[model samples]
Target: MALTTGQHSWWRPLAGTALVLMATAVMTVMLASGTEIAGELANRPLDSEGTATWGDIGDTALALLSIAFAIPAVLLAAHCVQHRPMGTVSSVESRLRWRWLAICLALALPLVLFTVAVQALMPAPAGKSGDLAWAGTPAFLTGLATVWLLVPFQAAAEEYAFRGWLLQAVGAWCRSPWMAITPQALLFATAHGWGTVWGFTDLVVFGVVTGWLTIRTGGLEAAIALHILNNLVSMSIATAFAGAFASDDTAADMDWAAVAIDVPMVLLYATAVLWVTRRRERANGTDVPGGPNTSPPPPTPQTAAASRPTGYMDPAAEA
Candidate 1:
């Protein structure tokens, strides 16, 4: 179980590079197929507006697929190669509890309310010209359901890989909690890319908050819950504003001010969730049973020395 020296610095970056390359290959294949399909099905040449819509949908699909398959597959392969046990991948069983669910909801509510309040304060963005004649259509519902199922899975997979497996691996290797956490947060943010200044900023802050939760709780479950909640909230808001904002350009119409206000609320909720869970752990005597509140005592010099081998030599023989 001992971490090898230099493993911390090298293992994560190498794994991440492999994952990214695999995802790139998968996306390339998907895109080439899509291109062939589009060429064959060109019933009518898409206008500039249609092209924008196509791009948005294509990008979303590709991103979801990359996270859903590519990253998790790579991490699982790495875990197998390292001979690391499956138990170390995530701490869900330790952290998942009804009380924690209550706390997560309590934390999410204020942020949701704040987002609503801010949206109320701002004028609705200009509406897209076309009727979403597709709004209540069965096809729309089917597509939406498909997206809901697939998108959450994609998000969860990322949380498992980055916050779960990678976090634990790095923590073990570095022998420092913060060293494991900082890199995960940075990588999480960078993965979102700098598509828009506001969105990128939001993701960076979100990454820090989630990373803190992972480190504080010694698990990915809480962070995963928070991430899923955040994404669901954002998606719901986007759906509501779909008609009000240009459908093809929703990112440009994002309520950055609202997002900024909601971010603090998420942090507050995360802290409250951690505090409540920790308190419960102490009350139930689970802290001693390896819950979040438990901290192992520092290694003493004698203890360290005891772990090393000792050798005896005869003085007369040496002479």
Candidate 2:
């Protein structure tokens, strides 16, 4: 379901984008500053790169939560500026499809696990330390807890901003999904900051894949599912190993080897989710109809009358 139609005006997307950016900037700064203060108080100041080390649970939460703030920022922009149901930013249906999200998540789990398994078997890069040491029970549990708790929201917030709000904003102005999807994909990659050429390209590929999936499957569920699982798996490994958290690496820092593995995994997920979406649509004999974009079956006369407000009179009846 595309956000191509509605009470859309050419300027709404521009206004909404500005609002989202301003709000996100404000919230991120507030939360990040607070985290920095807490870190200083605990004698665990952030490194030069502003990254938290292993066992620095407070700072880690702050970092993730800063990005998480984008969720409300986008929703607020959609509702207040776009003059549409806040849920519309979620999907064409104006709300999340819980079952569909769950299904996508299940589809993603195996592929992500397989990718992780393969990566585990691959040789480490030449400059990488192969030293193996556990991060102790307390540190590991705390880090894992933080990652699991906040990573989903962090991932979802990104989807809502780039794929949801930005995509819809552009789609409102242009009928072409490519027009809507491509800019956001490029922006999403840029937001990660630059690292290796392979890593940057890989991220762009991810954004494009997910953006297409959001339109094809009629929601952000598929993209969100893949992102959540991928992050959880990667961070869980980092949490388990001593000194892993001390590194300032992000997905943007990935090398060619990592990109080769990641790009294919995302493609596999997109293909599988599309196949399922098509199958479900064929079975129902229509587009998966849950959002405002899909027309619902007409109500029966009696049902319609019963559903009307008490003492309300239809114009036709009155005449």
Candidate 3:
């Protein structure tokens, strides 16, 4: 219904890209205006804030609100740039698949909890704080509350921007899903400013997985669920035990053990999600991810040439 009203087309991606960057810059500057520490920290980057106090958490959360602008940025792009309803970014159905989202959360929660438990057991690096027992304290409660209230929005904003918006934007321009997935993942990792090789690679992998899920499920629900669960627990832990988790992981340390652990975990999670979803799709006669399995019509030479579309023709089409 919405697509019927606008001058939307693949050509709008360029406009959408510009709008997203502008929105991000404007929001960050606005949000950073009142904070004294924003400039200082922007100048002196942290290995990842060692200041694990309530004030620190609140400030960090506030800074994160800048990234949160990406959600609205996407919407503005959808309406103003793409000239389509913003809901198109969510899926072909133009709505969130909440039922699928709930199932994804159920599947993802156990793995996230397991990852946290395993991470807690890893040896702390030198200069890392180990005094994490902040429970039963006013600070802990404040930090916990802040994270619960804000992390969902923060994580959702990120998913919508990278996996939801960028993925669709790039997909509009390219036939292969990898063409869309790769750039979005790269941008996502770079945006984190992880600065370390391990951090960058880890985020890139995370982005790829989420991007793939978006295409497979034809929506952002699964990606948003996983991101919120992963970040909410992880940030809350950091908030509660600010000094407890310490690592010089901000640097370019290509920690193979950490990478090795995560690669398998990602694969395991992907396999589980697909296996379950595939079973459901088959048993219930429903669409999952890539839509139904109806075979595509065989291509004709004329149709194949036409597939490139007019005015958007490849220069090498004659070849």
Best by lDDT: 2
Model 3, range 1-319, lDDT digits (tens) per residue? 0112235465687888899889988988777554546656545333344422324655667756877888889878878986666776766556676777788888888888887777678765455555556544676777788788888888899888888777777766565666778999998988776655776787788888877777665678878988888878877776666542233243124355556666566667777787876787676565444444553476576554333211111212233
Q: For model 2, what is the C-alpha lDDT against the true structure?
A: 0.78
Quote the positional error of residue 286 for candidate 2 in Å: 2.2
All-Cα superposition RMSD per candidate: 9.7, 7.9, 7.0
* Reference-based lDDT, each prediction: 0.53, 0.78, 0.68
Query: How do the residues 112-228 of candidate 2 rate in per-residue lDDT, one tens digit apiece?
Result: 999999988888878887787998998899899999999999999999999888887776655466777789999999999998898789999999999888877667889899999
| Candidate 2 lDDT score at position 66 | 86
Cα lDDT tens digits for candidate 1, 232-289: 5555444432242234442223446655765776677777767776677677555311
Assess candidate 3 and give its lDDT: 0.68
Runs with alpha carbons beyond 4 Å of true place in candidate 2: 1-6, 36-55, 289-319
- Between candidates 1 and 2, the one scoring higher on TM-score is 2
Over 4 Å off in model 1, which ranges? 1-63, 92-110, 113-117, 124-134, 137-140, 195-198, 240-256, 288-319
lDDT of 1 at 184: 71
Model 3, runs deviating above 4 Å: 1-11, 34-54, 126-136, 242-254, 289-319
- lDDT rank order: 2, 3, 1
